[model samples]
Target chain A: MAEGTTDVPIAGYSAPRPRAHGSALHRMARRRSTTALLMCVPLFALLAGFVVYPFFYSIYLSTLNRDMTRFIGLFNYQYLLSSNTFHLVIFQSCLFAITAVFLKALIGFILAHVMHNITGPDQKLWRGVLLLPWVIPPALSTLGWWWMIEGSYSAVNWLLQQVGIHPIAFLSSTAWARFWIIMVNVWFGTPFFMIMYLATLKSVPDQLYEAAAIDGATGWQKIRFISFPMLKNIISITTLFSLIVTFANFDIVQILTAGAPANTTHVFATYAFQVGINSGNIPMGSAVSLFMFPILAVFAIFILRGVTRRTREAI
Target chain B: MSSATLAAGAAAPRRGRRPSIARERRWALWTSYIALAIFAVGFLIPPYFELVTSLKTSQEIGAGTDPWFTQHLFFGNYTSIIHNPQFQIFFLNSVKLTIVVVCVTMVISVLAAYALARMRFFGSQMFATGVFLTYLVPESLLFIPLFKELANLHLINNTWALAFVWPTLSVPFCTWILIGYFGSIPKELDEAAMIDGASHLQMLWKIFIPVAMPGIIAATIFAFTVCWGDFLYPLAFLFTSKQMVLTAGIVSTLIHGDVLDWGHIMAANILASAPPILIYAFLMDYYIAGLTAGATKG
Candidate 1:
């Protein structure tokens, strides 16, 4: 009401720039390039400060020895390559990421299908309730889980005894230590995948299923042909994105076990924090963290390709 | 068969739906409800126990007591945490830091997204692509060097330093999400606004922002949740008990030494996680819309 659209012609209507503001230029009515560039200054500046600069700085830091006085130049990287603990760190990180992501993806896919099958007002209610795990901060939730699963006083163990089963020491044992770590990760992460897959399911046209029904196609055949193909791209994309995140996850292991039972459960982030921050070995820590970069870069490239392709397909 | 064969399976359901098809769907819906009910019980376990633990007294939280049920309710846990000055400081610090980070992120992302999506300029396309690519940069890889840089500036071990570093986590994704929102707006709005002599800032303020409010809310929620829940930055940057925010503070301070206070810790956990939970509950559609928007559009 205040702007009065047609009555008060906006200020520059009389200014003569018609030729410059040709139909081609007026497509979104191009602003002067300078204005647009000026607007993006803060964005570029931050990326430089936070990502680009620190990335190079990490590479530089990784080259030095434990002391800052001398540059060892790839010695730290070579040292990590042969180190026994570092070998386990790399293996554990990959193992943790792949297993957690695979479980989360499978569970999320099933739950998403379940969510799609429900058609009523209660769908939103169920979705809101089911998504609670991803909603809580993992650090806090991990604390809750740790309290449940951890020690002599563990309620989970107490429950096990009530059922006449032996209480398993989740953290102290080697295999179970890894199991719980990945389990916590899947618990924290699965809702994200479910929600993403649910969105994918929603986007598929419903009529195709009806048509399939008319043709006497079984539900399994419909899924094998239609849903799987539609879900394939998003599944790959969400899985790739989750892979990068789970690979670098720090909070769960750090708080829960602190990579205990002799550092058997450490992923890259926790191990880096241990080597770099806790131990005060910056160079070694940098090298440990840097190992994740190439793998992350590969996953990221695939996701970007997927996202761009999806955008193109949507258009 | 339809002339277009399988490709035309998406052809509209003709007349009344087939009875078997309706029966199959109804059966699927019932099965899905049962499946989701089971999953919901599984999903709610940890939080339920956490809440149950919080409601029990400190003495009642051990192995002997039933973990699943709280027979005698105790509000003392909440009162104790509320009375603790240290927790008060941590909660207040989180609020302050998250507000500033969310505001700064929104400003940078909204402006940057508007420019990139609408105002074509030198390297704008690259910057737009850069926004998406930056989402791939894990905070773990950058934290070590960022810690060094913050220490060099004497910003380490300070709560406010997080205000600066936290935006790095949120800005890229928020900007990308906003770009999708702005990109989807019809170009005609822009051309009309431009011919009316409105400037870029004016158009963004008066035209684009109103239409994209949902996107802005989603991005804001994303930024707030990221900042509110972040562990590493505060844990690395602020080590002192007094300087820490909620998540790192609770983990580092509340759990000090060999003795565990299960009731107090669970109480604190519930309190610390309340903001994100509340936001998710209220603005769920916006939150999920943001997620889908980023995935499908951005």
Candidate 2:
């Protein structure tokens, strides 16, 4: 890698060397640099045109009025700050993300441990079955969830009624709606956590566990001392990554609740869509969504730092 | 070592002394099994119910029939949904968008990843990090401005519009995954090719790609699934029935505000979910490997 970078300027400047040195080196260097640039052109173009450009454009959009004809300074942010619905959205967004991430991490950790203990073809079969929810599209799976928890004909409610319990209104009520929303999020997301933790679990040397066993370490002790420490970096990274995703999640909430039961369940992304697109206030929607940036940026910086530190340590 | 000997000693008295240690291990294993079984059942109930409900007659579904099983199987739901003209358009739009987006993403990511992994340009490190950062930028953050951008381009409600926008999401992660894969390739192979007068493009096309086939396939699968499963972009940008992808299309068309045909809705969802689930079934290892590679390597 170092050689590739160093060779370029040397080849480009080789023509200035003694006359005996040929133009071939310079041409080669020039060709290499051009090739590298050419290779990256499409990627940078896409990133700039779509990702980077829209990002800045969103900030600009947020500064505009409802119709977006005129700039209104920080009015959008100021308005959202004062608005009660936006306040609910902010609170719900944080609550939803934190609760869902915590549950997903916990459930996924447990599932990974179960999977780790189960030895044989059964494990592979079980893994395949367990990951179905994550493999399916969120919107589609949420559709299934919607039907299962439909207000009138909830399958779960029906099951409850079978045992002489009254049917619970899964989606019709605010609390149940919030509960089911987070439940579906956890269901859809846990497999990813499971698969990730399972992969990390596999890397923990069996010899270490055997040593722990020889020292009279129980299962929990092994996990606390050996497993947790080995998994600290991955857990932190995956949690933060999942936190960002869960915070910005739209499909589950949108499909399942659509901010139903008086809009109490709306998170940042869904509320942004409701206000921005559904209500035709694109600027406010942009503002709503833009709120995710600062929070995610903080997490992204930490994640990147963790990644680089891990890479450096590996090297 | 002492525990092993103690277990051996306990097991030596086989008449009436089943080793408590062995029993404890069995109990632990059984506990894992029971917990996994319960979770799996709960995890599978929704899709299972969807499948079962999709087979129920409208009368059966409407009459609040058994939620777990259908008395009479009705195949009409699948047929009606499959034959619906609006659904046909949505299906075609989804297929077209997914194919185009996946192709564009793979081409762009592969080239960029090769450059970042092999050729050390002046700002390669920063550019690589930029790619990962782009991956982290959620669709929620970009869709508002992107909607405006598409409107300006007169591409709103155009299925082809997704061909341009989906790459923004796919390329970054695909590039990141490919970088890991490409970086893992023995540096000497590319060096040997370079020494033998292989141009950078030749070295990439002829040497790097063939060796990184698994990574390339993984990236392709990832891109395809992400594009196919995307909801927000289609929801925000494409309004017409003719342009919406499967996810947005199914939700918009199947469920009216007050009246929903649960059978058809379930069928549409199953249909929409089929590709990714099928792809996952066949390439489970590759998918897991790619996912783990991206996560753990970072």
Best by DockQ: 2
Alpha-carbon runs more than 4 Å astray in model 2: A2-27, B1-25, B257-259
Residue-level lDDT of model 2, residues B52-134, one tens digit each, is 98998778888886789988788999999999998898999889889888989988999999888877768888999988888
Candidate 2 lands at a TM-score of 0.94
Candidate 1, residue A315: the lDDT equals 92
DockQ of each: 0.51, 0.64
lDDT of 2 by residue, A1-315 (tens): 645544554455455675535556556556766788899999999989998888899899999998889989999999999999888889889999999999999999999999998988999999999999899989889888888887755788888888988877778798889999999999999999999999999988989987776565777998899989998888998999999999999999999888987889999999989988889898999999999899999999988877777677656
Tens digit of lDDT per residue, candidate 1, span B1-298? 3323543456546323534556777888889888999989988999999999999887776547778898889989899988889899999999999999999999999999988887666667777888888887888998988989888989998888997789899999999999999989886687688677788799999999999999999999999999999998888778888898999999999899366777888888999999898998889999999988888896
Q: Per-residue lDDT tens digits of candidate 1, residues A221-286?
A: 988888889899999999999999999999998988988889888889999998889998998899
For candidate 1, the TM-score is 0.92
* Candidate 1's DockQ: 0.51
